[model samples]
Target: MKKNLLWLVVFCFSISAFGQAPKHTFKLGESDFLLDGKPFQIISGELHYPRVPKEAWRERMKMAKAMGLNTIGTYVFWNLHEPQKGKFDFSGNNNIAEFVKIAQQEGLWVILRPSPYVCAEWEFGGYPYWLQNEKGLVVRSTEKQYLEEYKKYIIEVGKQLAPLQINHGGNIIMVQVENEYGSYAADKNYLDINRKMFIEAGFDGLLYTCDPAADVKDGHLAGLLPAVNGIDNPAKIRKLVNENHDGKGPYFIAEWYPAWFDWWGTAHHTVPAEQYTKKLDSVLAAGISINMYMFHGGTTRDFMNGANYKDISPYEPQTSSYDYDAPLNEAGNATEKFRQFRSVIEKHLPAGQSLPAIPAAKPSMAIAPFKLNEQVALFNMLPQAVKNATPLTFEDLKQDYGYVLYRTTIKGGKQGELQLKQLRDYAIIFINQKRAGILDRRLNQNTLSLTLPEGDVQLDIFVENMGRVNFGKYLLENKKGITEQVTFAGTEVKNWSMYGFPFKNINSYTTKPSAIQGNGPTLQKGTFKINTVADTYLDMTDWGKGVVWVNGHNLGKYWAIGPQQTLYIPKEWLKKGNNDVAVLELLKNDQQILKAIDQPILNTLKKINVE
Candidate 1:
């Protein structure tokens, strides 16, 4: 009997210690979130995986935890995952599941927001560029084509994340359906479809929809929880959630903005940390859950940055640096705001619990000035031209992003007002290999005078797809390059030779040595060495508008037009020895010497002639 009893005690202890792990249940309650039947408050911060390097995800999450945040939020970019239809990339920086796993490892819960149409200033509102080629397709709606494509992508995401939910023994507690849909349109049917898709994709956890406080009624579905964004009044947030959620509770403030994103020509948006601490304190004191929009706004690298356009606001393309002046700066350093917010959060922490120590800032260094003297003209490296009677848009030619050159032979006898009908963004026109003038869509100026010579001249119009609109009704018609026809002297110019410069691989062209001549787009190349690799910023003060690449990695676009004058170079992309550098300068560059500095110059602005 004694031997049997001893085995029984050991067996009971084993069952308590290492038997099947108990499943956690997270659900919305009358006035609070219940975790395993106990009321829980989520203190979350938003950090995008694509924006931050995958190598730095764990460090950023550590920073968030040190700031007293218990949860981490992120938007899984669709375009980043599936740049082309039927092709998916989930490796390296695109490994979102790894990001979530890191958050869980840091003892932080995750709020999975794998919305199909996330408008986080991403390219095309996170819709793959190939969607434009689909006929009669409407995104963020009940269009059959859109729904079919969205289902495939979302289901794939579910396969990766569904098993990680709280009930399945992971830290993911909630999954958001659609991102700010009510701000775009009031399509209840479309929102419903999105909800069903998430459920069918094996997302059996609690689901929610987030929108501006005013548009919650339009975006919120019947069964899911309604989360308010933008506004942060304790009473107002509670009232909005109650009103939309059938007078129930468990209110969530999805996106409480501490600062705003900066556009190319505008001033960097900054919000004083002290200005919002009072509101943040009141919200937490009232026992409401909150998620800061950007605890650390990382870089919007490459050509992935989006633009803003509407009837009231002029066309404004967002800067590549997505440093939203949050608690953690773009380089992931804790700022004064970080200290202020931590003090405020300390006041709300439970007894006997304290925030973790803030992690040390990453190392940074400055490099001596370097020169890019080797030159090659952009026209010398054109791909095989696609002959078309009419000019083709970036989408029509099956080319997404980058520049497209439209060339045609025109009679030189008559010269009048030359106009490009509905030019997508920016264009530089040349006549017989000589520059004529430039037209910018941002200023809504597309007409310029042309002087035709005696004989037939090659008229080339170089158009750049600056960025696609990420929000509002304008996103539906957002296509790159010439969307319509080009006219010289009010006459339609036909029989065009279109050349697409996707620049997916420029190694072949950048190596072909050719002497630079005239004031046309040129490719400049050089090399530099660093003793120790560290995060730095490339100063673009003297260069004209163009894209820059280091060691073959695209560093994104840089223009002389004010606001952003430097490009951030993450340490992960740099090496200790020699590094190859190249720049595709769109305009003329008087001086091609560049320098790497330790700090970012995000506020510097230059005078632009839009006239």
Candidate 2:
């Protein structure tokens, strides 16, 4: 018990001695957060640095401040920082320091939830795709390769924000370890190592672990406080936290979700602001700290978007507009939910404190439908194919997102069942350059039966990387495109030429006066001129499935079957005068023209049958 007493002495001394002066001490007490030697409350809201544009960062912070939120909780996405493993990019939009400093300037405290394995519905749960290429590497486990690589990543992050922790007089008060790991595994050794790594990374602030209340025992580490997520019954959540923390206090709801996310073919989610505001009221009234899961859910642009399941549960690709139906809409406008939430927050504010006025919404305008007059067929843009005996997965070619093409020559004839074993996501079949059929994993489709003319028929399969699984134990198998070999009936097809279409690397794609060929994928280009550009959404309601690019900046995918038909085009990506727009339509039907609209079509979930 002497050792325990010594630790208690150090803890009490740290709380007291560290509490005096400009360098504020944020310590976890028996039942409260002692900020500068007094009980403190953290009224925080979740926001992501990458989701919001670098230009609009200040405005979003202002919106959070106006909503009566005192703290901003954000997760540092790992995959974004280290896109191509070992090659890190913390400059420009990738800079998380600038985002934190901006929040501090806005008079808001910060809670840094740096989940290296963040499962925020992000691509590969924020894991770099290159990790899959590592020999014998397994993520989110006690594997040696994963731990070594994970340490390097966290150390890089520590270099940027270690000095910003609250103990160093910065706004960051609390830092999280791994995210929701108990939901996936029960490895206490992994949890212990993660805790040790965070400390080694120079995060001297109060550290904690968050998991669903049901899984607290497996997720929470000893000596560190435990926080619960998705808990509505305040008493039950608090009980779980106390049980995990040896009946200690500082009851906190790490993610009291007020809204939900959407999938590609699923309906958008929303709860009447009245329903959740009441729960917030009760939670706060009971003296429990809370963070609104997402006060302003923004967009997930380009190939950065992640998927849910592959060949299971309809291949749910998370939509671009992460607009989790929060208080602030995708365009940063104050919704009715904002007003109701503000009132509820005001009711629970400290006596003599007041909230700032809600900021005015940004301007939005609509433009006429611009025709994609120029065209380029998929077959015409092919580079020298990489000869392979069988199909290669995206990881095999070191390609993360976009499409891959496989082609072979049929000797006798092409009238048989073309079966693809372990198809990743989506694919289109062709025989002698003629569109045969589609094989979608959403409907569990793997075989395509077609008839082709006799003699040396060219068989092609263009596979698209819809997205990789962002969540679940199935993440280990998230290799995109065709994973295994293709078969003609019971026979394995060999001697194939493969092509990789990693769209991000392409600088300039040429268009020609070409006729639409063989019912295949096409690249259509259009031009729009603007005197002074403003933020607008590109309407893709009339379009089939494809990705859209504006002046070379990828605006992300769109489909006529809705939920999200309009893509948010940030003003920063636009310029004065003529701008080029390109669309890569995989299954073109009626969408020939793109419309610049005043608003987003995020809620339009149209009925689509992939089968």
lDDT of candidate 1 at residue 123, scale 0 to 100: 87
Task: Please give, for residues 1-611, the per-residue lDDT of candidate 2 as tens digits.
Answer: 99999998887775554332246788988888998899888888998888888998999999998988999899998888888888888898889988888988999888887767888888888898899999899999889999999999999899788767888667898999888878888888889899889988888779998888878888888888888899867789778988888888898899988888877766778888888878888887887888888888888876877877734466787888888998888777789988988888899888899998899888877777778788888787897688878888889888888888888997655477889998978898987777788887877899987766878888899998877887887789888777888888678998888888777833467786556666678888878888877889988876778888888877777876668889998887788888888888888733577788988888787765433
| Candidate maximizing TM-score | 1
Identify the runs in model 2 with alpha carbons over 4 angstroms from their true place.
Answer: 1-22, 310-312, 412-414, 589-591, 607-611
Best by lDDT: 1
In candidate 1, which residue pairs clash? 562-606
For each candidate in turn, the TM-score is 0.95, 0.93
Q: Write the per-residue lDDT of candidate 1 for residues 1-611, one digit (tens) a residue.
A: 99999999986774443222337889899999999999999999999998887888888999998999999999989988888898988888888888888998999999989988888888888888999899999888788999999999998888778778887778899999999988988988888888899989978789999999879988888888999999888899889999988899898999999898988877778899989999889999999999998998888876898988999977888888888998999988899989888988999998899998988888889889987768877787788999999999999888878899999999897779988988989899988877788988888888999778888989999998888999999889898888888887888989999998888765766544456776678888988999898999998877778888888878878887757788888898899889988898877644678798999888877875422
Point out the worst 10-residue segment of candidate 2 by lDDT. Answer: 14-23
Question: Global lDDT for candidate 1?
Answer: 0.87
